[model samples]
Target: MEYELIDNTQAKQYEYHIEGVLAKIEYIKTKDKIYLTHTEVPKQLEGKGIASSLVHSVLEDIEKKDLTLIPMCPFVAAYIKRHPDWKKLVLKGINIS
Candidate 1:
């Protein structure tokens, strides 16, 4: 399946889609940080690693723009926790709380 990033400014979020289905993430940007706030994948889209792919794409965008991340979304937090190497991309002194 192919995925595309949609900047849904009206909704204040970035949406990732797979074959027109909202497969993974909804994020917002503020200053130099990208806040991953919500994520949802259809039950059928689960277990196929769509979420991971979406996260990777978002991270790539972050890196390209030299922006940091605030993982407000649980899935993003868990992904970061599981992959400590990516922690450097997180904004310093920024608390999700």
Candidate 2:
């Protein structure tokens, strides 16, 4: 499944609304980097692969904007681990362990 990742800059998060619920990845943006700090998907929507999609969208957006990523959220970190190609989008000099 695919969804548009809404970069709600005013909310400091990327949002996706599906089935009338909001799924979001919160971020903190600096001049050259964005710290993906948390991910939230309602319990009713778990186990549906939505979180991975959200993370992918956020990573793609960060890459398009040329901003480094700091995956502070454990969920985002695990997603990156599973999708290693996206590691190139991470901020340099930071260990995501």
Candidate 3:
């Protein structure tokens, strides 16, 4: 499967897509952090790891841009918890807050 990130400025959100299936992600930007609020991968796309892939891609972007992440989305939080090495990319205080 192929994934792409689209910034939906009109909706004030970012979206991940695998073909035509869209995964909605809510984000809030602070001076030094990007907080991922919520994520939803359609039921038809469940169990296929699309959400994981989307989270990975978003994290990659964060790293490349030298931005810290506040993973408010449960899926993203769990993903960071699983990858301790990536914990370095998380913004301080925001993790617990």
Model 3 weakest 10-residue run by lDDT: 88-97
User: Candidate 3's residue-wise lDDT over 10-97, tens digit each?
Assistant: 7756788665777878888767788889999998889988887878877887788788887888888988888777788887665632
Model 1: per-residue lDDT, tens digit, 1-97? 5578666767766567665567657777778878888888888778988887778777777888898888888888888777777788888875433
Model 2 poorest 10 in a row by lDDT: 88-97
Best by lDDT: 2
Which regions in candidate 1 have their CA more than 4 angstroms from the true location? 94-97
- Candidate lDDT values, in order: 0.76, 0.90, 0.80
The per-prediction tally of clashing pairs is: 0, 0, 0
Let me know the TM-score candidate 2 reaches against the reference structure. 0.94
